[model samples]
Target: MEERHVIVTYRLDHATIHELCAQLEPDLMSAIRHPTGIPPLLQVLSVLHFLASGSFQTTVAIASGMSQPMFSNVLSRVLSALLKHIRSYIVFPQVGDLPAVKGDFDALGHIPNIIGAIDGTHVALVPPSRSEQVYRNRKSYHSMNVQMVCLADQYISHVNAKFPGSVHDAYILRNSSIPYVMGQLQRHRVWLIGGSLYYSPKKVFQIIVACCMLDNLALCRQVPFLQEDGPAGGLVASVEPLDSEEEEVEEEDIDNGNNVIQQYFQ
Candidate 1:
């Protein structure tokens, strides 16, 4: 295929495509037939095309020179291989390097002690046979409520996607693993910026900020905002004072050199 064709179809250049195929080939080689089946490169290309375009299996199969069933099987195998190897590529920022995370947020909005931003978004999906009504959201559609935490640079630090669409964002956070982790690491004076849905004075110290404009800017710049669709509804601007207990903790941590505004990524 021509370079332009590769780029448009797979959203990757020829060299990068080849490099990815080479890396994935070892895991896929056993599934390929010697002469009758599709080549490994073609399988990778077909799967990439399907993913990039989000087209139906039948449509993608026609372009890939394979039957729909074969294309589906190939896609599943390729996805399985990628999932098996995903851990090597995706990792959260280390606990020791949190100061850098704070610095990045400070540069963006002068928000102090901000280690990350947290938000929940809905992903549209076909209704499941079981408990279909539970998946219907306020907008009258089925979805999965996915929550994510990311740094200022848009790197995701945590994610939880198990909740149904009808579940409230705050409820998801309250039931999530984040609170336990934060409690264990209470020595750090870190906070996350979130919208009204995540606001709770007693649950944790999440900064409630009007993030619609910042979210739009981040999306345009491809800043990896947690939501796959886009920004949630607009939020009214409001700032609540930090609790007295939190203020004391922050002062102690600052005295101990755990300054949340320390220079990061020097």
Candidate 2:
């Protein structure tokens, strides 16, 4: 039997580290009030290492030569502090922030009559226990339901990540706080393009029903109404098991459309 030892070393980028340190101020302050004796950076490192590797907290702490309890405390505090401070900055668009619609269009090379695009993607997560039924998706895996709206410039304009994988895309859209801000006190019509999943009969009706409940919940505060019977109709469709041929066709169409959109924007 042969045993091998490997050593790896890399230079740390000082400027990037400094920026990260500056961002840690709020977390540092919170840590000082915490009973945990671990330093804020070490705790943050514990969390970063875990996230970067998707390892358990205990494993991360052991690999880092830190106590598990201290590491957990620091990770929790740092995450809470950072999320509290930076969430608003990273996850939303301003009111009236839709893309330009037909004004001096050709001169600026802007696509007229386009407001926004909506899409759903999956983010993988560690599988939880069976008790977390709502998190287990149809694929029998755990994931986060990620819904994103990007502008014509291709920047992520908004993100809705509060729902579990089991939740449908329509459900997230209906429950999101985005429509309230975008459609408040005005007839804001954003061009929504999505797959059948977004316009499935069950899903569309579900979103409509959810919107109604939300309206009632908020004393009839106007929310973005889904046009179930208009041009915006048939956005999402119910999930169905796809045959290989159908799946391949869908993939090819998606790839071709993505390339065209990318080239046009470029």
In candidate 2, which residue ranges exceed 4 Å CA deviation?
A: 1-13, 32-36, 53-63, 95-116, 124-131, 151-155, 184-266
**Model 1, residue pairs in steric clash:** none
Model 2 error, position 176 (Å): 0.6
Task: Provide the global lDDT of candidate 1 against the true structure.
Answer: 0.57
Q: Lowest summed-lDDT stretch of 10 residues in model 1?
A: 201-210
Q: What's each prediction's TM-score?
A: 0.64, 0.51
Writing each residue's lDDT as its tens digit, candidate 2 over 1-266 gives 00110000001122322344467766675556423344444444445444433335555656555545544555555555545444433444444444342232322444454445678865544433554677677788655677766544444456666577799888898898666755662355444444422222222222322222222322222222222233532222233221111111123323433443233223
Off by over 4 Å in 1: 1-7, 33-35, 196-266
TM-score of 2: 0.51
lDDT of model number 2: 0.44
